[model samples]
Target: MKITISVEQPTGDFQKKLLALLADHADDIEPDATWTKERAERLYLALPTNARRIVKEAADRGGYVSADDLRSGEDSSLRGHSAAIKRAVDRGARDGWWPATLQSPVQAQGPGFGKVVGYLIPEYLVEVFQHAANKPSRDW
Candidate 1:
């Protein structure tokens, strides 16, 4: 027997908001596509000097990229891309660009041999909460 999976595409306000966010950050680094560090640097440079400074600072502080950097260029890592997308969506939602819905945190069971007694949260939101009591952080 074979099982089929159905995919639900993002639609309505979600689609429109998602598209607008993509458009606003089109120059940013994309995942799985052929984008070089040189291109990312160029895009980063194209932004306002303040934005560039923010990216540099964030990078220096051990952040893969500043929120500004992600906004200005396409990132290759799914985590980076998701974070950037979230930032954009959050911004647009705040600005009334579209009605935003609550996206429950992504979750997963911890690796174990016996009965599942523990859970692991996504890495991103780990810093926010004291424990993994809530839903897992976003994962691609």
Candidate 2:
């Protein structure tokens, strides 16, 4: 079944890091040329299932790196990479590989709860949902 996913635009630290990374790749590159939600979704679809799984699991765990983590310099690159993985998963969800209905309940609370429910959907499925949502007749 096709699932439709809606995603908000990337903002704040996520946007800044992405722009910096792209700028480092080449001179004269426009900061605005960085990947958009549509581009991110496509990249997510191209990833192998294993990579997608790693990303999805990480997102499920809410393993976001804080500013302190970056400043510490220990495992900084790893955390950045993980953050990129998270963006991909988020884009995949936006595109529809992961259905909104299956997303872990936002209102849910308690320790270890998100881990148990959030990882239920595989990454590939999230991608599917995202693509489905992008179809012409799909609603937001």
Candidate lDDT scores, in order, read 0.37, 0.40
lDDT of 2 by residue, 1-140 (tens): 33322336777888798758767865644223233345434544545554343334433445322323223334423223334445555665567555322332112112552222222223444444344224333223
| Candidate 1 lDDT score at position 7 | 25
Find the candidate with the highest TM-score and give its number.
Answer: 2
Task: Please estimate how well model 1 matches the true structure, expressed as its whole-model Cα lDDT.
Answer: 0.37
Clashes of 1: 6
* Candidate 2 local lDDT, residue 132: 28
Clash pairs (backbone) in predicted model 1: 28-73, 28-74, 29-73, 29-74, 29-75, 30-74
User: TM-score, each model?
Assistant: 0.24, 0.25
TM-score, candidate 2, is 0.25
Tens digit of lDDT per residue, candidate 1, span 1-140?
33322224656988788668768966772423222333233333333444333334333433333333334345422233233434544554454333344231222132544323222323443332222112233322
Ten-residue region with minimum lDDT total, candidate 1? 126-135
